[model samples]
Target: MSLTLAARTQHMTSSAIREILKLTERPGVLSLAGGLPSPDSFPLDALAQASERVWRTQGAQAMQYANSEGLMPLRDWIARRVSLPHWQVEPEQVLVTTGSQQGLDLLGKVLLDPGSEVLVEQPTYLGALQAFSAYEPAYRPWLADAQGPDPQALQPRNAMNESVRAAYLVPSFQNPTGHAIDADRRAAIAAALRAHRVTLIEDNPYGELWYDAPPPAPIAASAPHQTVYLGSLSKVLAPGLRIGYVVTPPDEAPGALALRARLLQAKQASDLHTPGFNQRLVLQLLADGFDLDAHVVSVRQRYKAQRDAMAQALTRHLPEGCIWQIPQGGMFFWVQGPDGFDAAASLPDAVEQGVAYVPGSAFYVDATLASRQQMRLSFVTLSVAQIHDAVVRLAEHLRREGRRSC
Candidate 1:
């Protein structure tokens, strides 16, 4: 007998990045494909101490089931940590999620309907597309330039008469592309969203990972009532813990109360709640006076050095006509190989040469329209020496492809 699946299953697809990741696991392959933070940055000893304290003091409470809204103290901490001077986030509006990915899924469940129009960057976060796709929304690619996604696209214009349910953005050190929206553009985006009364989903997993200076205040600061902000500790802390949060708009905002209630119901239906043990563990660490600010500073220094190494290697080894900009922060370097290069088709050869990178097409909503020459290379996980070696292998692969085309 054959089992029938839901219609939505047709839209569900495995992440191309993950599929490529499996290929890179072969021995001796130096992968530049994953957005993995360096293990050295994790405060192992501090976490160990915190774990012991939690087990000794509140093991039973930690093991027991938690409320759907998450631990109150942890929620309070998140609210305070993310709250800006202009935009104040309250604990009551916070929903702790398994990860920011779940926040995306939950938002998709509560906000999107089949055929709903959702604005997205031309090449946005692939995981988000994966999550939103399950809801079967019609994606409208937002116009963008070198500064990042254009704000004017948020306005309703020719051929776009339907109301946009929501617009998703990664304004700070976005995935696949290391572009960050500058201050002026962010303010303009906020204004456009407010003027058009469009809801904004701002996912900021890498805002705290800056090297030179912090990014501008989130667009939410200016339009707090119109934005649902998602944050994650995966990049700055350990991803294994899977701690992330969703900050809903203020209760006073339009439909904010109903939105919050529906999101909580979605969370309850998704998983009774995120693990209580992980929430307590994070609280325990904070209670122990772990200086997160100082820890973040240290991480920035290490990653900046790695970024520099990757920049130098690319400049020295890449074939003529290859293009990339040294990212100010974040893990990946978005690279475009010379004309006639097909990054997707060249992956097997690159992996064979002992290096691997994610093809840029994977990040675009319409892969058919994506640039064949672009690829994303992550620099955070590897050492300076390993970075150089990976670049050498990738450059060799590109040069070989170029010669073959000639």
Candidate 2:
């Protein structure tokens, strides 16, 4: 007889990106698949020096179990860094998380009631959808246009069975699409959330990787009382450190205070705390005078070159009917092929031909509405030459499928 399983266990599924990364490891394959930061950009020297300092001066303390709310100094630093001139975020408002991913899990646990509505972009971050699915919230797509998801449409309507609990978005350098919400849209979205009284989960892991000017201030700045802001060190520093923070609204609001307390309880249940050593190591890194801004400048330079190469390669190699909007910043190129070209179904052929990308369908809440012709390709993991060659190979394969002219 088969062993019994919890009903909630059925909700979990493997990450498609992780499954695809395994295929990418086969010999001779060039993958534009994983949304990973370039290893070449990691500040190894700074990390090592910081680790050594953590061991040398605060050895015992670093190994000791930390608080569920995270290290005070680390939280303080994050609060100050994210605070804008108009919006002041105090250390009491910050909670250090295992990663921004954990912050998503914690938010879902504390905020969502099964069947509650959660508004999302047309093609949102797949990880977020995965994280929130365990809580079983109903997703309603925020209608999007040339500018971005319209704020007015995101407001509550007579159609929903239940009240909208929250709206989640990657407003800066959005995952999959790589589209940053402009300042005007940010204000409009913030206003709408306030008007409708729906909470906002502002996930922004890629905001700092901007190739040109910084994206606008977070939507949280506009509707401070209504947003749960998330930020991560993974893209800017190193993913192995696995450090991120969640900023709840100011403490003066009792609702925000209660939400923060419940979230800490959820976090304590989840991991006790983010590893003590990791927290100290990051603090030590800051104390050692690591210039994060300068480091990010170097990272942006490398990624910009890669982004440029992929844009050029796609323009030169892909068929006439294929289309893509050159991303202004961030890691991916969201490409759309002609009608009748199914990106998800073409995966086996793409893999066999030695090139790989993530089909866009995995990002949508209603998989039926996902564009069959669309795909997301990440450029940071491959060299310029590799990107050029891989696009040529993919274009050749598309030619065989009747997508290319010659």
Worst 10 residues of 1 by lDDT: 154-163
State TM-scores per candidate: 0.98, 0.96
Candidate 2, superposed: residue stretches over 4 Å from native:
159-162, 403-406
| lDDT at residue 146 of model 1 (Cα atoms) | 81
Clashes of each: 0, 0
Tens digit of per-residue lDDT, candidate 2, span 1-406: 8999877667776788899999899899999999999999998998999898889999998888889999999999999899899999999999999999999999999998888888889899989988998888888887788889988765657766334788899998899999999999899988887877778999999998898789999999999999999999999999989898999999775499899999999999999999999999988888889988899899999999999999999999998889898888899999997657778888888899999889898888887778888999999989999999889988876776664322
Query: Tens digit of lDDT per residue, candidate 1, span 1-406?
Result: 9999999999898999899999989999999998889999999999999999999999999899999999999999999999888888999999999999999999999999999889999789999999999999999988788888888887776565646889999999999788889999999999998998999999999998887778999999998989999999888889988889999999899999999999999999999899999999999999999999899999999999999999999999999999999888888899999988999998998899999999999888876669999999999989999999999999999999999888
- As a whole number from 0 to 100, the lDDT of residue 266 in candidate 2 is 98
For candidate 2, the lDDT comes to 0.89
Measured by lDDT, the strongest candidate is 1
For model 1, what is the C-alpha lDDT against the true structure? 0.92
